[model samples]
Target: MPKQNFNEKLIARLKTNPDFVDESGELLPAAVKDHAWKLNHDLIKFLLSDPEIKSTFFDEIDGHWVFNHNTFIDYINEKNFLANSYTQFRNKIGLNIDGKFLPERGEVSLVWPYKDCVLEGGQTKEAEKRKEIFFNEILAQDEINQMFDPKVLTNWKRHTTEGEQDVTDIQRDDNGTIRENLIIKGNNLIALHTLKQQFRGQVKLIYIDPPYNTKSAANTFAYNNTFNHSAWLTFMKNRLEVAKSVLAEDGILVVAIDHHELFYLGALLDEIFSMENRMGIISVVNNPAGRQDAKFFPTAHENMLFYAKNIEITELGRLSLTDEKRRDFKYEDIYGKYKLNGFMRRGDNVRKEDRPNLHYPIFYNEITKQTYLERQSDDDIKIFPIDDQGIEKCWRWGRDTFALRKAKYIEVKKIKTRYVIYSKLYEDEYEGEKAKTVWNKPYYSGQTATQGIKTLFGSRVFSYPKSPYVIRDVLEITTKPGDIILDFFAGSATTAAVAHKMNRQWITVEQMNYIETITVERLKKVVGKKVKEEGRLLEDIDYDTGGISKSVNWQGGGDFIYCELMQYNQAYMDKIQVAQSSEELVALWRDIAENSFLNWYVNAEVPEEAVNDFTALGDLEAQKHLLAELLDKNQLYVNLSEIEDADFAVSEEDKVLNSEFYEIR
Candidate 1:
């Protein structure tokens, strides 16, 4: 039997990384790896013409490798030879009555009109051909080796670094569950790119509250603050592209933005989701505090756009209560658990091919009290077997179903080709009216934060959180129990906390500082944590007046793994360029090793035996240390050095020909 595949998602992920490269600064080989399409791992294995690519370019410690863009490009082209492979595929398809020969350079073109007829990408052959060429060209370009729009990458990385942001990393626990919580940092561009694997066609619902691009001088929008109209639109556009992929066959995509970006976002949504999936736009009155604007109408309403992947004539029920409604609701089991449906059974409305055994209904024999259902000739009628009771009631079901339904069904009551089905309820049964185009629910109404916080947590260390009632209301309506709820703009983790309380896991990512008092404090109170802490986290989150100070200043407290996104410094890169000899390189490394802000405590010692040429330990003063065992050509050890004195302790030993060891350093 063929084994299952896990590399499918990983393969898809590799297709997204343009800057991914080998040690020589060339494009990385396209192989199965960390990122692959969901389930494709079974179909394809991770491959690499050169498997040591990561160590070559990423590590940069190996001196044998040199960064050369042109050479790397050549290698990528050679490695991607299959992309240029072409073979005729025979196909039989349709044409118009007079035969429609599409025009040259039509917007769309067929990939292999013979084997598979999948319409995707664009319509023009020229366009598709151009795409093929462009894709190959993109693969061969050296631009990928450069910083990805440096300013954008830097700002995003800086904003979403470990301590500055809170992003939950989750994955599907089982295939049965469709929903999952995802929190991604870095530039949303890169983050979304990575998500193509796990989420393509798998997301059931998406709700994004993006920045509204309102360029109001007094509005005050910034990196960490909020987005102005153009900025927000651009950001949303990039993120939506990936979000669209995660949606399921019957999935939905929703966006939350104010008037500033509503019109534009609506247009963009139409482009990606298409007008068919565009269920409708909802106007939410979020703010009760009206801005008294003298010049224009004060901005108040925000848009909640809804879209679904597919629409069908599904006879869904109305509400969960009511006498008349329950009457319409049918039951099949003893406990009334198996509700009966009125729709034509799977075969209700069928073509002739479906009911081959069905014939015209026959009348019952009143005098003989015998039933005859199937068509019979003179001889066949005599053979029409009689029931033991001598009363034959003609069956209403088709001939083929007579035996099957007879075996399973014990009809208690029956009407003219219909049963007492449970569906479509009256207004009286519901606590409120059925859903309307306008959502006037308390969640949408806003201004309930104080009450909700007090109810969920009585002044336990947090305040002014979103109402879980509202989040629950929306989830009950639009989402299933298994769906992933993403709140990138989550204030106090209201959405996630609500989702969790409802047994729905969620991902909450926030960048505000004094996080303990804001998102942290709220989550602690909301999650109803049992563990008590020694000290407070960050004092508050609303202190920053703008995006950030650019110096990677953290304004919060509490225990969190401290880390910041970092890259090679240009000045250091220049110094490395000038150094041609190993001695110079060593000196350069020494200078950087001593000067960088690594916050090293020299007394830390290296460990006994941790990794090759390295060890973790505690030094004389009892600080953490990392020791590396320097080796010679025959793999002979030379000396041990401390990499991070505060992190590890180090010791080295000399070994004999037979692998006997002696303490060397």
Candidate 2:
């Protein structure tokens, strides 16, 4: 059997301990702790002293000497070694980093102590399997499971959409709401991963129109056009894991896709959501580029593949205009027997006994008191039945049914019309109107085009995006009222707007900052004007500004602290070092980086008590304040002391390395 991995025990320890990545666990990065790395080769040497761990697990493989640890035994045994020399290994990781093992607040990913690999595709099968298993271990680790409780996130109060929010000159909403409902600006992958525990199986609906797989080929049928198919798939897969987890039981995930990756995407979705609950596709017109100017069939239609949690069990409801519905629901036959259309049309042989008048060359309508032929048209001429006493005149229904229809018949003479044959009229479950096989809905050009088309439109008035009318028609038959709607690809945030208009509270998530900017602007204009214009989006007599639309109690809003992820790049540090003043620091790193970096999650504080009590990253805003305190205290002397003692040497081999004494006070 192979030796155990360090992570197995580490993960086990973290689950029970919230500060698995903080002081109580692995110490935070010294840069974050306001210090430098200390050299302690003694610990490194001791770690290497484990002859068994070194020789077997750390042997050279794929030209790189990396350890492989997968089994529980490997973990337990290493736990024994680390326990025996816990201080040694811990010090080894922290060695050359001068900071004391200080606690940091907040929850953070604990995938450190991991040496990143730059060379790829050369690992042994054993090594590959080890990495895969280790990755899974990290994802399923105990501390991660303890990060956030599902019930807690579910109970977090939704902000009111009313009142004065935290709008300022720097972060003001365009229409001037204080702030947004949520701001997640970090790597979406990291954000999604962090949210898995708290949101799993709770989101009602998810609509993501991710980038398409088309970098390898030329095709306009795509979403994100920059990455390769595999890259796009990988990016989407990571988020899908969280998105899937976030869904409520009666939820759905609607992905927007064109012709390019339709087949591939369909397969991917099948894998994600099992084939069992996938309903048929709703073909939508996202654009109007038709066959008019094409060499091939127009590919304007998009597939919004609907997936229901439990179709029969879902709470679905709908209300629409009854007048617009087709009226050719029932038709009467000429045989005096009320016959139906699209039924078996059974009358094996024309029986004279079944209907004595069925043998007539023409049937006379007693109501109109006029002779009628095959079928009646809406013409003023009083004419009737065209008959050769052929198959058309055969009694389609039982005589018993014809009598029922005749009893319910109400008619006036003067106009020519067929007499009511009960089977053709009041027949149970008739296949009513003949539906047209082709739907001719066209995709209008995007608003950017329309606004430009008319100079008077300031990208505002009549921002009438592709209406909710389209999605409503598709959903009315499929969804009942109260089902949650979602739109991750919310352009102008109209999907949720439409959902609200149709009595559904929709959750829309937009990843693009510019789009978010535009979303806030459009929402302020539309929702505000809508309230002032159409009252509110509520159902109750007094309940105005429903959850789906803008609300009155809204705070303008609460505030969110922004943060960025730093991957320990030397250049990042260099930029920090070169900064001359606080103004420069704010401008160069703090301010710009906030908008540039993606956030993993937002919380009042990272839950690790000891860490929170120590480090500021645990409380981002607090962290910045602490940095101010650190500067005022002028603990620069301690940093100066650290730089003096480090083993400064230069190796010609790694020439691109820094040769300066960076651990300055």
Candidate 3:
């Protein structure tokens, strides 16, 4: 038999018992208290096979020896020996120098929830069926240790337009309210941490459409740039951990991904946001007619993993009724347009035995063509539930309920030989329906997303922009009119445009060079600004009008600030890349020593005064080599800790702006 996985509820119950210990005398503290281990059916069977272990954890219940939670935790902890000491596993994939790995300072190691689960291919058939137990190995490592290290945010500037006038330094509106919307151009990983300084625990919703990392060269939508499995996992792991920090306790996170990385991403999310906090997985059929490149089953849907910081406080908004749904109320009465809905209970456990009180009969008067809960005379015809296919069913209401509400709700119709009963479901009394997990909305298609960008920009500028309507729908469900929405991946700024149209505050970040050309220009058109594309007005271009501006009746007036990560190492790298000769390289090396600050991690012993010694070197090649060794190539931004340092030269004007931007003062 396959192994059964213990749920969080069972784990919680196990922690309450004090006498829980395994056959090997190991305590259950780690597994029960820290969620450090999980018990599967196979492992449970193994324990039961041993008399000493079985006696401790199993109890006879109704002829079966059921596994006890207290004993199970103890048994698993003994089988997998865990220690409090921090230890380094060998660098199998070569991510570190000298084949020795060290955990980043303050990194917490998570215990593997399952033991002896083989994840790699070529396991037994039964083991292959137990994929969830095996998959937790992918998330067994410590959380990305270097995630929260401080970085710099620089090149701050606000961008807005007032009736064809380009404005830059206007920080406040006419009423002096600080602008809430922001468009950041930089590495999203660094930008997320930067935004956390001001917006942590304040943002209500986050919708990120990150790189799918589908390794198909022919796939236009794939990021094209590929990372090995481990690298991809680390990249997503680092970003998601920080993203979770910025979310409010009641906030919702919606991520869009395809099949290629769905399982891995889901596992990573399980580790970051404990499995208990997962809201649901929505399957959106973006391409109803399956893609041609699919090998086995033609792919038609993408997954949207929705999670809440706290499930108790999370509530989703409803979707409005469509015209087709409204048309269901075809019949009219004095009350309103009404529809005939059968007054019979259907589906599982709906028989008389299930709801005995609701199985009563109704009386139909042949003369007046009216139904009643009570019989008036002997001539009155009695009716009972018999479905269209002639199977017996039960009435939806009890006798007392039918008696009190029959006059207003019950309707009678005469078939050839019998009477049919229905309840008048009125259109005026209809509330919106709950949003479903399967989304087949018309506007979620990739074609719609493409046309939306083309219509706004007068050409195809971005690859695979999400439909603004889809974003609007997400916003409508997850946010109120004044809530804040963030999209760090901000491709084509669709989330920002939708948020602006929906009257919600928004923040978006993009790392591409097209931020000025495509993302900013799209928003400009959204705000009714006449954006010029190559010296021509976008409004003059002939294109189909199906985007948010036309649908929302947007006239447009809002402001957003644009900024970039302050360049330190990248500036020097840029100069080095452009140097034409050895003399130019020598000059560039001198410029870097004067302008940039070296990362403290690079070499703490090297003092700032020692920079002069390198610049004094006569050999050009030696100068280049020494400068490369001194600078930390990975630390692109100036550290926040070094903002006040003399080498960074942060002016008084910048210090005030930095403080104001972060809302720290």
Q: Lowest summed-lDDT stretch of 10 residues in model 1?
A: 130-139
Candidate 2: segments with Cα more than 4 A from true spot: 1-205, 213-226, 246-250, 288-298, 310-389, 392-439, 442-457, 460-467, 529-665
Candidate 2, residues 1-665: lDDT per residue as tens digits? 32245444333533342321333344222211111112233422433455544554355678765443322223322323333222232233231122321111212221111111221233332132111000110122222332222110100112223422322222223432222233222234444543344345655666655544442221321212112243344445556656777677777766766666777677777777777767656566545564354457765555666666655555433333322332443345443423334211344554554455544333345545443333354432332222334334344444454445533442323324433322234333332332122334332234322332122223232222343345545445444455555455454555554454555444454333333345444444323321232754432222223222231132122222121221212123234334454444444434323322212221222233423233323333222222221121111111112222333222232111111111112
Which numbered prediction scores highest in TM-score against the true structure? 3
lDDT of candidate 3 over 59-114, digit per residue (tens): 98887887776545444333212221111111111212322222111122211111
User: What's the CA error at residue 629 for candidate 2, in Å?
Assistant: 29
Best-performing candidate as measured by lDDT: 3
lDDT of 1 by residue, 307-343 (tens): 7767452111222332334454454443242334321
C-alpha TM-score for every candidate: 0.39, 0.43, 0.65
Two-way TM-score contest, 2 vs 3, winner: 3
lDDT scores of the candidates, listed in order? 0.36, 0.37, 0.62
For candidate 3, which ten residues in a row score worst on lDDT?
A: 129-138
- Give me candidate 1's TM-score against the actual structure: 0.39
Number of residue pairs clashing in candidate 1, backbone atoms closer than 3 angstroms, sequence gap of 3 or more or interchain? 56
